[model samples]
Target: MPRRVAIIATGQTKHTARRLDVNIRELITEAVTRALQDADLTMRDIDAVLLGNMEPFEGFLFPELWAVEGWGGYMKPSVKFNTGGTVGTTTAIAAYYYVASGIYDVVMAVGFEKQSEGHTQTAITTVGDPIWERSVMAGAIGNFAVMATTYMHESGVTEEQAAKAAVKARRNACLNEYAHLQMPDITVEDVLRSEVLAYPVKRLDMCPQSDGAVAVIFAEESKAQRLAPRPAWIRAVATAHEQQYMGDSPKRLAEMRSLIAASRRAYQAAGITNPRKELDVAEIYEVASFAELAMYENLGFCDRGEGGKLIDMGVTELTGELPVNPSGGVMSTNPIGATALIRVAEAALQIMGKAGRRQVEGARMALATGYGGNAWTDVMILSQEKP
Candidate 1:
């Protein structure tokens, strides 16, 4: 079997709608330095650097080159991956493979994005098929709006249920110091009254495009023992992809097969059958409230189509049966490329017993996941102890 790989350290910058005060290199350096500090090591100790970014949004075609020098990746092995929103988690998983393959003892993964630097709408719209879908689909929001309509109809989820998730995320953001949108006492009624971006999905339900960076350090078990007193071990990692065309999918558009398959593999690998009963917490990507609801059902936290009810009952809140997205989640602050890594970092901190006010008491096992463009999904299970 491959050697055990674990996250010995993690760090993230405070998320904001715009980070005009700092340049790209400076932003990445901040995250990298903090991660190394958390690991009690210097940049020289890192054997490899895996950068995750979707640079088209920033108009920087070669951001990795500019980022490496500032991030201290002079001579170390380095590579970049761009898998839409899945990039961050995929970068961390790639670092795991590097350590698990015995090629590197210590690896660093960094994810960042500065939407304020360029035109995100143009970048997102470019993903559509130039000949067809681009002309009809409004954008990612419209694409998801279609799915939301299907989810609400087939799953019997009311608009109010989706509103509850927005309220929950906004409330949780108040507890997260690094979160961009920290509304103290947002109510479901507030969400319902919020401006409608698309039918069924209100402005509150959509994630705010932001700028930030997150970094994580991975090490083999032996290396981790030397570096961290309580490493957050990676119990399982899986990724699955589906075709992008909306028409290619069958009925019930929100029922993502990729996420379902990935979740099952992750559960098996982590030896978790009943996630609600076994896992202590979750930090899932919530680009929209509907996505979170669908994830709840797809990840097996509840029966199919029951996720909407789960949110309305406050089952996914910080004080609920299984606290989720204690860090405020993407809906509260979405840094595109960095959002998924934030999920990973938040979950890891929970397992390490380091989460501040949002910490779940006695959290030992946690899960984080990513899902976005092209119907890609990546699931990661983390534990306080080595597997």
Candidate 2:
């Protein structure tokens, strides 16, 4: 017997470099209130809460316990999970389980990151062990740069091909109302000529730190029918964790073994054969231009090492075969811990036809993927109709 879970409500705050307008409680309230309105329900309708966050980034040990009340959890059952960048998607899966397992009728899944309030780079640097790896690794961008070099060397991808992805993302970001980075008139030549941050990775090639919050309501099938006219249902979800050390495997090992394996299980469970043909839209976690190209191969859109070809041919653009990261993706609006769940939420919004100007045309099926912590991975398949 399979249980059914659907997202009946979705809400988000404006993504910005710094949010001095509201406190944490106010930010939480803004998203939750909007979700309730979208579901045509009230706070009283929620049965539990699941929060996703990376505490170290905010220098707070247990912000979830204190912020639960603001998320409308109050005395209700509430808990938070931290899994590097996978926290958001991981939290959403937990909320869905709470509903599908008959433990809760409605669960509020929320993820937020106020990078402006904390030292994000220092927090990210701590992901690697301080004994050896931390001293050598510059940080996320540095690690990504090394990986990008490997990708270029292996796949024979030109720097200009990867630069195109950056231009497309910033262009898409301009259409995203909640997006903080908007470069409507950007071009590949512009990214190629931008200031280099970490060799292959340029200042313009990387995503910006953002302060934002996103909330969605997960309801049992019966409750979903009463909440919204149409709901984006969760068909299949899978999570896989890899070794913690960066040197444990080859440079691109995580992309193939951890990320791709989880996606295979998710796609198989969702009855998908060809992702390029089956998925109408996708929101992937690609913090850099090369990562997006690598994702095209990892997600089965193309063969291994052919990801660069996909970008060069303009296959990932909004009007391409499969519209990817139409909401500008993590590359355009990264909120770190909230990024994975933002992918999930953005995909759901596309399926619900609520993505505004960034929405894909006639999108019926969508996918969202999360990758972080060197080895941790989570892939989720969502649809306008159930599997």
Candidate 3:
């Protein structure tokens, strides 16, 4: 059997619209530096370095060659993953498996994106189904718009409910210093009134493209305590994917098959029969407001079609029964490449008691997820207790 592993430290650069001051390498270095300091380690202490990002988004090919010295991968085995938006979760899982398998004692995983420097929508456009690429979708906005509208029809969720979710995310982001967008006084009405980007998805409902990076140190079980006083144990991880075509499922948004599969298996592995009561906090990937609501139903936080009700009841509020996306979430800050890793980093920070004003008090268990526009999902469970 493989040895246990845990996240000893995590760090992230403040996310924002543009960072013309620093190059991509420097941006990655910023996050890596903070992670190293948090772990109290130097390059000599790291066994291997793993990195990931959507190269198309930044128009870079073979990124490890470009940012070798940036993430301290000098003379170290460097592996890069280009799994689109799920890159972060896939990279972190690789690090965990390496440590758990005894191939490495300590590993660093970095996820970064400089979205301002590229045309993400255009890049995303090139990766869609060739059959319906031109006629059906214009990129993520058009695809998600269809999903959101269909979900509304089948689940009885309203634009008002999605607007509430948007309000919750941005308002919660006000406490996170690294969040890209902070709308402290944003209200549901403001979301409803904002200019619609594509149907129900308003400017306020969608995530902003940002330039940011996030890094975390994963260690073998024995080295975990030495690395940090409190480590976030990797309790369980699960992933699921759907067909490549976006039109594979008509009710894709209303009933996310990949998310449902991933969350169920991950929860089972973590021995969580009641997620809402068992997990303390959740940092899910919601590119838009409606996605979160859809996730609420698929993740078993509530019954099907009750996502709207869940938001209206404030169940996922900052101080509510179970807080979701206390780090502002993708709805407020989405650096596609790093967004998934940001979710994991925030969850680990909560477990380590290192989260600043946005920390969930006495948080012992947390859940994080990664969503890919390519029809895939990754779910990871972290806890204060050893698995």
Candidate 4:
């Protein structure tokens, strides 16, 4: 069995539509510097560095080679991941293994994306099967629009319910200093009136392309205890992937097979028989408003098609039975590559009792998830107590 590993520190840059003030390298350095400071350690203390980003989105290949100095990986062992949106959490899991295997004492994982520097939609169009789905694909919005329509037809989920989710996410972003969209006064009415991007999906209902970076430090039990007053222990991790072709699963978004499988495995490994009751908070990757509701069911927070009811009952509010996306989630700040890692970082902050204004009172356990490429899911559980 792998040894215990804990998150010692986490840091993120202020997310925005465009970060013209700094280049990609500087953007990465900002997050890395803050993480090292938060851990009360220097570059010399990091045994290895792991980084990830959606290279196509940034029009760059082999980014780590030129950006190494910015993340302090000049002479340390380093690896990079480029898995579409799940790159962030994938990189974090890699760091966890590095420490858990007893090969490294301290590891830093970083994920970033400068979407403004490249053609995001054009890049995303290439994700589909080149010979089969590429020509007809209209990027993520078109794909999600179809999914949203299917969900509404089968589950009676109205556009208003999705609007409520959009309002909740942007409102929550008001309390987060680093969030890109801080709409404290946003309402369901405003979301309903927003320009329709794709049928059943409005402009406010989708996540924006953002520029940002996130860095996190993982350490073995002994070093973690010495570094952080309250370390977020990694209790369990699970990942699942399915056939890449969208046509392979016609009801893909509604079923979300990968998310269900990954969450089930993670819950079993964490000894969580009842996730809604056992997990204190969750920071799920909700790329679109409707996706959040779908996740509530797939993650076993509620029965299928009952996601809308959870939001209506305030069950997932900041002060409810389980708070979801208190950091505003991907809806408020989606840097694609860093978005998933941000979910993990936010969960760790809650477990460490370091989440400011948006903190969940006395949170002891938290769940985070990563979704990508229409069929991949990554689930991680963190807790204040050792597992």
Candidate 5:
């Protein structure tokens, strides 16, 4: 049998459009130090390290070669990963496998991004097909705009409802100290009034290009129990990928076949029949406001085309039955490489009662998702009780 794995501690730096005070190395070190302090462990206790970053975004090559010292991987096995925005969660899941395989008892997973150092749009444009989509690509905004338009046409979801998601995320961010966009007084009207970067996708509706880092410590069952009073057990993890071509899945965002498939397998592995009620909270990779509403349906939080209704009924608010994105979600803060990992870390924190002001009251089970490249999806379930 595979060894049980759990997250004993998690840490994050304050997210912002720019972190001029620290370079990439110092930024990563800051998160690592905080994670170690949270777990009451030193570098001596870590058996290995996994780092995630969108190297192209920073024009950096071989990041792990130089980031080793900052992550305390000087004499330990270490590796790096890059999968667009899913890099962070991919790294975390890899670390989980490392410990569960019994090759390492303890591991540190870190994800960081310094978007201010490079041209984010230029880096994102490279994600498209070189010959076909690259020449006409408008980066993430245009892609999401097209997806949002298709969703609106098919599901009857209106701009006002999408703006509600923006409002909820920013308001929720106000409670999270490490979150980037904390708009306590934001309203749907404000979102609609925000400048339109792309049709149907306004400024407030998109996640900010943030400079931040997050770190989480994982350990085997015995080590986990000794490391923390309440370790968030890793119940299940699943990942699904589709063809890279945008036209391959015309209704990609609206239907999100990858997310549906990943969530189905993950929920099954965790023995969850009814996600809306079985899961206490959710931390999703909602890159855009409309994407959140669309994910509500794709993740089986509600029936198809009922996502707007769910949001209208306050079903995803902080005090709702199954609160989603209580950490303000990607719509509030997105460090690209670290965005997905923050979802897992936030879920673990909720289970550990360490989410501070954004904690879901009495949360025992939670779901985290990582979405990237319009082609990949990762789903994970974490709980207070062992699975």
Candidate 6:
């Protein structure tokens, strides 16, 4: 049998459009230090260090080579990861595997990105296949806009419903200290009236590029008990990826095949029959408001095409039965490389009873997701009890 793993601590820096005061290396250190303090442990307690970042977004090559000290990986085994939008959670999942495999007792995963330091659009454009996807989708916004349109047509989800999701995210963000957007008074009207980025995807409907860092500590079952009063046990994790080109599947966003498969696999492994009622909270990488609606269907939070109805009913709100994105989600604070990892960290925080104002009351089981890299996805389940 595989050894059990649990998340002992999580740390995150204030997310903002810019972090001019500190370099990327310093930003990395801030989250790492906080994770160590949160766990009440030093570098000596960590067996290895793993980092996740979008190297192109920061215009840095071999970032880990120079920023080793930032992650406290000096003279210790270390690794780096970059999987587009999924980098953060991918890092956490990899660390979980390391500890659960019994090869390492404790591991730290860090996700960082300094979008202000480089041209995100240019860097993103460079990632395309240069021939196929470039013609089908202009860029990230264009890609999602097309996806949102498909969902709108298929599900009959109205613009009002998407705005409601934006309203919920921004309002919830006000209660989170590390979130980038803090629009406490934002309303559906505000989202509807906001500038349109691409068709149905309005300014508020989309997530902003921000600079931030997040870190989480994973430990073996025995070490987790001593590291934190309440450890968030890893229940199950799954990853799925679609074909690299959008031309291969134009209905990618509407179908969300990767998310559907990954989430189902995770649910099966976690022994969850009904996700809508069984899971307490979710921290999904909802890159856009419409994407969140689509996710509701794909994640089985609601029947297909009923996502609009679910949001309208406020089923995923903070006080809802199964509150989702109580940490404001990706729409509220997105640091690209660190965005998906924030989902894991926030979910773990909920299980640890340290989510403070954004705490899902009495949360026991949480679902976290990461979505990026040609429509790939990673889903993880965290439980308050050993799984």
Q: Per-residue lDDT for 324 in model 2?
A: 85
> Model 6: runs farther than 4 Å from truth?
none
Against the true structure, what is each candidate's TM-score?
0.97, 0.97, 0.98, 0.99, 0.99, 0.98
* Candidate 1 lDDT trough over 10 residues, lowest sum: 245-254
All candidates: CA RMSD in angstroms? 1.3, 1.4, 1.0, 0.8, 0.8, 1.1
> What C-alpha lDDT values do all the predictions have?
0.86, 0.84, 0.91, 0.91, 0.92, 0.91
Best by the lDDT measure: 5
Clashes of 4: 0
Count of clashes, each model: 0, 0, 0, 0, 0, 0
lDDT of 5 at 210: 97
lDDT accuracy of residue 100 in candidate 1: 90
lDDT of 3 at 74: 89
| lDDT for 365 (candidate 2) | 88
lDDT of 4 at 338: 91
Task: Tell me the tens digit of each residue's lDDT in model 6 across 1-387.
Answer: 779999999999999999999998899999999999999999898999998999988788778988888878888888899999999889989998999888999999999999999988778877788865665555588777877888899999999999999989989999899999989899899999999988988999988889999999999998999879999999999999877766644466668989999999999999999999999999999988998998999999999899999999999999998888998998999899899999999999999999999999999999999999547999999999899
Model 4 poorest 10 in a row by lDDT: 245-254
Report how far off residue 30 is in candidate 1 (Å): 1.1
Tell me the tens digit of each residue's lDDT in model 2 across 92-147. Answer: 88988899898799998988888898998878888878898888775687877777
Per-residue lDDT of 361 in model 5: 94
Off by over 4 Å in 2: 248-250, 253-255
Worst 10 residues of 5 by lDDT: 244-253
- Per-residue lDDT of 110-164 in model 5, one digit per residue for the tens? 9999999998888888888888888987589998788889998889999999999
**Residue 119 miss distance in model 1 (angstroms):** 1.6
